[model samples]
Target: MTDPQIERKLIEIMRIINESDRPVGARIIADELRNRGYNLGERAVRYHLRILDERGFTEKHGYTGRSITLKGKDELEEALIGDRLDFVITRIEDLIYRTDYDPVKKQGNVIVNVSYVDKDDFEKTAGLMRGAVDYSISPRVGVFEEDSEDIFVPAGKVGIATVCSITFDGILLRHGIPVKPNFGGILSVENNEPVVFKDLISYRGTSIDPIKIFLMRQSTSVTGLLQSGSGTILANMRSIPQSAVGDASLLFQQLHESDIGGLLAMDNESGNVLGAPVDVGLSGIVVSAGVNALAVVEEYGIDVTTRPVSTIMDYGTMKTL
Candidate 1:
């Protein structure tokens, strides 16, 4: 077999063994491989097992079969790293396709960004989030108790879900308007007006969410924006065909009327959106980032772990911030 083919089979074999509760035999591993569409025979599986044993990735249990070792687990994680590249954009596209939100009636499942905060800081976090309502994708927010069944909240931590801006893309798509997400960036704001994107990370390039990266680097001055209207904030850019601009505008207005507002700027007749150049035949659309509220909580020295475009939730369940 070619090196790539052998590597794939070995990875699959290790995965099968890792998932089993007890040591797995070659016959069982071979059967599972076939179930997963790999037609490896028991003998081939045993051969691979010997290789794993030699490499100290697996330990043979006298006649009981074999178990994956700690080394094996680490290797597996490292090997799968390449598969995670561009995962952020893939997740965004998947959520957009899964969205069934109806802005006109404002009653359907919509995308949300999840955050975890210490239970003791929940009230403070909520208040801080309220201060940045103007910069969030929607005023509606969902708070889950530490023991809430709706979402998994870590021990002593509360889960907060915010509306993601991708909901706009989904809404436009429902109306036959296709939208292409461009990037997530830090937008410089002065006097409560957005100036330009100071830095941009294309959605197609990175595995980690750009907003999350910026937050980790302490790159935001959201507190300044909240106090003096001059600081950097998180934002996203999208592109839509020029012909659908009229329809998109009408939908955006309806969305605003429904209490969902994140529209920052759109391309004008000159094909420039807030000083950002747009491609021919397409208009660029910029909107407030969903995680901006979480950024505020972080600025206060409260710990927060954000999952962007994490999951979908009923719009009615969220309470206005």
Candidate 2:
């Protein structure tokens, strides 16, 4: 048989054994394969099982069923990684809005806002003009200097609003604010980085307090993600709710307030998208925090399953913050 075909059967058998607390026989294996759309028979399965036992991938207990060995587990995980023939692209971004716009020139135009950025602090302050690059935003800088009872607004400064402009559906900002946001670890979903809430940004809806706190935890974990690499994230989730979140920029504002180190979220496809605002065009998503994100999800009685990654919705793309 072809190596790939043999490898496929081996991985499937390993998974069955791993999932089962007790030993499984060849007949059971054949039945399971048939249920999954494979048409292998018990005789064929036994033939392969004999080969597996020879390699120590399967341990046959005389008349009893068979179980997978440690080597089999390693082989399965390796196969999972190798089976990643495709990737879901997620574009990373920062909390942003157009800060540089002439109210006199482009008044009452549509503006877009997002809640995560990949640039460092102060770097975006100067170069974050309109269309600086693919994802950079141009917003007015609002520099404030309090003079006794009076307020002084300077031309450009960090963490301040500078210009006056109208925002439409997408949220064009006169004073655009971008905060430092981050995430760590990748949810191995097929071959793509996972996206939540259509943009990987999460916000409100049903137990928002705890969920917001969870997002903060992962965001702070970005730098410490073990053996992590940089990748661009772009999200495109369906049915983003605007009412749950008011302003998209505020989501990052809270993330900054939480002082998150980086991003560590999404084991795979997630329904929880955190840190979104109302009326910023993008919608809100609820996320959970903790080392076991799935456990947190299950605590709320949400059904979780492991399926082929192709079934998930297209969220957004992302980059290292």
Candidate 3:
């Protein structure tokens, strides 16, 4: 086998072993490999198994079979990193399908972004978050202290779960409207109103979260917006079918009245929204990014670790911050 082919086969074998509940034998490994269209014979499987053992990527259990080691798992993840380039958009779609939040009835789970800050900075973090320039999904937030298990809070760190704007997509899906997230951008704001997009990262093209990249660069001026009503803030652009425009508008109004509003602007008639063009037959929408509040905290020079579009949480657990 060529070098590349050898690596691929070894990685596949490790994956099979990692997925099995018990030690996996060469015969089963060969069968599983065949199911994946590898066409590897039992002899080839045993040859790869020996290579894996020599590399300390697998362990022999006397007569049982072989199991993947921690080193093997690490290697697998590194090898498959290229396959995860579209992980962000994939995760968002999955969450959208899982979203069951209802605006009118006000129940069910919604998606949220999780951030961790030092416990010593918790009070200050809350204060900064409260000044998010009104670009967040909603005023509701979930706070998990150091000892809380609802979400992982590292030692001496407090976890803050902020409402993700993707909740809008989920809500719309529940109402028969499909949403396609296009990109995340730094939206210019003037006099507390959204203007043009200053910079954008296509959701379909990147591996890392765009908002996280922006925050790390300190590229957002959320504090400026809060103080002077003009600056750049994180925002996401999405599209819906033009046929659903009217119904979507009414539903968004109901959402606002229900205090779950996040819709910033919708452009169906013009097909141009803040300098970003919408495709034909689709209406463009710009919604507030969920991690904007966390960005506010970061702006204050307080350290924060953010995980955007992180998890689903019960709506009832969130309270006004």
The lDDT of each candidate is 0.83, 0.34, 0.82
Over all chains combined, what TM-score does candidate 3 have? 0.76
Per-residue lDDT of model 1, residues 1-321, tens digit only: 338667767877897788666888887787656534467888999998998888888999988889999999998877645544555576678778778888777789888888888888989998999899899888898998756656645457888899988889888888899899887889999999999988888787776677777878878889999999899988888999999989999999988887788888988556677656678899999998899999988999998988777777899888997
- The segments of candidate 1 whose C-alpha lies over 4 angstroms from its true place after superposition are 1-81, 269-272, 275-277
Report how far off residue 67 is in candidate 2 (Å). 0.8
**lDDT of the structure predicted as candidate 2:** 0.34
Better of 1 and 3 by lDDT: 1
Better of 2 and 3 by lDDT: 3
Winner of 1 and 3 under TM-score = 1
lDDT per residue (tens digit) for residues 1-321 in model 3: 438668877887997798666888887777656533367888989999999999999999987899899998889878745644665677678888888988778788988888888889999888888877377888889998755646545557788888888888888898999889888889999998998999998888877677777877888888889889999888988999999989889888877865676678899768788877788889998998878888888888998888788778888789998
Runs off by more than 4 Å, candidate 3: 1-79
Model 2 TM-score relative to the real fold: 0.33
Ranking the candidates on TM-score from highest down gives 1, 3, 2
What is the Cα-based lDDT of residue 285 in candidate 3?
89
Give the better candidate number (2 or 3) by TM-score. 3
Across 122-221, the per-residue lDDT of candidate 2 in tens digits comes to 3442332222121111222222232211121111222222111012111223333222122212232222233323223231221112222333333322
Candidate 1 overall Cα lDDT vs. reference? 0.83
